[model samples]
Target: MSNANKHMPFPELTANEVSNLWSSFLMNSMQQRLLEYFLASTDDSKIKQIIEKILTQSQENINELKEIFDKENLNAPQGFTEKDVRIDGIKIFSDTFILNFCFDLTHLSISTYPIALSECTRNDIREHFQRNIAFTVKIQDEIVELMLSLGVYLKPPQVAIDSEVELADSFMYLNGFFGGSRPLNAAEIANLSRIIHRAQFSKMIFVTFSKLAKTKDLKQHFGKGRDGIEKVLNSLKEVLDKENIPISASGDYLISNVEASPFSDKLMLFFVNTCLGIFCFTMVNQAMTSSLRTDVVSKLGKISDDMKKFYGSGLLLAIKEKWFEQPPQAVDRKV
Candidate 1:
């Protein structure tokens, strides 16, 4: 360490800062290890460059987080390891799928890191999160640019109407139950695009995980989840395809029907749970609201509820297998 960098005056990290950093360290560790496999499997030079750039940034974040943990006298998280990734395993996803995975994860980070940043108070912590957010935005732009150049990019379909539907009367908008069930607006349409794309990705990813799970029960669970998510995807697609809106991240041509266990059951289950949370949040905040079409609102609400139930079951499974990592919690005042 440089003497100048080592000797900077820094305050003790708040509990929030410490907890956030701990969680990020574990997540970045998992991503970095996953990228190792992806980088090895990709044959395309352009895709390799993008993955390598992202992976390099991931590694730097991992190191910086470890240094903070060490300095704070906190035990570094075990996170994932060589065992978490099957080094000599068969290639599970095609290069196209790999690129989309990167894009999806990066897109997700855009929403997640800012939430963490909101709670941060320390200057160093805030600065670190700001930098992380900036880097993520860059990666997102690069992925989109490359996808567009590759001609595989899924753009949201353009909406066309002969005339502006004047909100001339109170009957134009409707609640979830009664009257004024109107067609989707631009915002609602955009949210549907987001929801549909996520559902499609989840189905394909879980289907692969279902086939690759080491245990029969987990396999069945993943398969069932995949099937259930497929219904939701279809419903979402019906909304879009009926209107002829282009769907982005269509998982149709990406993943191959492979026979290999590329990821551990624990890793795959955790991934499912994390995405479930993101989907639920997106649906409620963006899809289910005042003025959305009655049927669309109900559909989004039902799917969000199903995801919550699925998350609960997954939590139980994770607990039983001792795979769920408990985050830091405040001390009980009663204790």
Candidate 2:
């Protein structure tokens, strides 16, 4: 390495880099508050340790993002804060639910960070996402190990191996609409299982949030979310059931019936609107692209369309409540 290379001036952050950092800052800040509440309420020592690790990582990411925003002369977003969560509030979720939530968070990070990393032209921004990806992977492994030990891990459906290799010979291979369709492939099975699991989690979240929401309107919003997830789950589950694939049981029992809200309505709504809602679209798109069967793709398309409407409603609610934060925008030259 030449010393001159190190002395080269660094360029300004690109739009992609800023977008990643901004989104990341808001996510970590929200996660930090949620983890704090989880840490306060959790009783299991092992799960507590995991929450601590995640919380520390979230805090560190927020600090680094603050530094970047300051250096770029950009105002940091007013993401979730201490006011968003009441650490002393009664426990709303079982320890198992918290652990599973952590696992899902890591899963999302693993899926998304690489895309963020690839889009960045700046070295510092790339390094930030690189570190995030590495950390989430390690933590995800730990979470899996813990879940397996605790007997809470839900394994995906397994496909039997075939000794002989065969290639598709006819257009009928893609035909899933007519009778005598081909059996589900490994990729199709995996995507279906993943979507099912995500929907299960979302259902339970909506259940809990609905019960704890302060106002009737928010409660109805979350209740509708719960109902929407149920429909998606049924549609996807039917696809798997026709193939005789078994999925894990629902997590509805993991949520408590506590009527008191541990988190502010703003925080809860933002989470559903931004984090879970956006990720649902991403997963559906991935499934739709990977699915070879026409029927499977058609079902996924319908699911995606339903989610768009549901998430659109949530976004509108966020705006109406003033919970939606504006991202970075270009200055108006005319002004």
Candidate 3:
């Protein structure tokens, strides 16, 4: 054994680095399958070019993630295979639907990549995720421009302006759990509005997937997620309503029953769980800052907890069915 090698500082991948690698790998894999199918059916040359670019980036990431896992002597789990998607099968989603999905997908990546970048300690790891952030920003901007130009962009409702800036008068603004508290801040309002929109999106996803899912177990899981997310949305909206803040409009109710599976049950379930994971990440970030208000912290915390428990159950099912991919971790040396 090399003595100097053993004494190296931070030689192995940190937990944050491992997670960043694992999540990026899994998401890239899933996106690859979806993008391939979209590209096969896309007739518009512009949309096909965008899809191809994303797929190329994903392939580059997949190769790099494999390298990272190999260096760590970890098994890079095979998430979904060709069985999960039928690339030449019936085109289940419309071109518009495909474009909108890509738009949201890139935006989600843009929002979460910074959290991964922040927790990275190794130079190589930081650079990898930083590239991810940059690439996603580029793609997200293009998607937004396309949506806006096509008049298909869904915008948040306009909030009435205060017109004048006001200074903080007291710390009572932070109180809410036990006593009087000031009105919601700009951050809290924005957070709540975002929550509502995402909840609506999740609800629509569940409704469509539940009907399309061929298995009873998967159907039940989708139904429960639909109910759970709706509950969280209403709870958060109550707080905003109490503050007399107007909530933003919900996402479009444009999804119709496909009556057949375009994607496997495994894929849709995993997709739902992925969204729940993002919601948890976002909720903690927003709620901790909103804690200055009374009752808001506790309410949001409970919702996050409930979401974890719900997602945990579905994750177990995915694992049992061999649909969930195990993420990379440090080597166990007990042998």
Q: Which model scores highest in lDDT?
A: 2
Give residue 86's lDDT in candidate 3 (0 to 100).
78
Q: Clashing residue pairs, candidate 3? A: 174-292, 176-294, 177-294
Model 3 lDDT, residue 127, Cα: 80
Q: Compute the lDDT of residue 233 as modeled in candidate 1.
A: 83
lDDT of 1: 0.77
Candidate 1 TM-score versus the reference = 0.89
1-335: candidate 1 lDDT, tens digit per residue: 35665567788878888788987887787787778888887888999999998889888988888888888778788777778877576676788788888887786677778978998876667877898999999988999998888887777767785476575366446543454445667877878887777777777877778877888878888887888788888888887776677776574345555566667788777777765556446655666763257777788877878877777888898899999878766679997
Name model 2 segments beyond 4 Å from true.
1-9, 251-253
Q: Is candidate 2 or candidate 3 better by lDDT?
A: 2
Any idea what lDDT model 2 has?
0.88
Model 1, position 331, has a per-residue lDDT of 73
Assess candidate 3 and give its lDDT. 0.76
Ten residues in sequence with the least summed lDDT for candidate 1: 171-180
C-alpha lDDT of all candidate models, in order: 0.77, 0.88, 0.76
Off by over 4 Å in 1: 1-9, 161-165, 175-180, 241-259
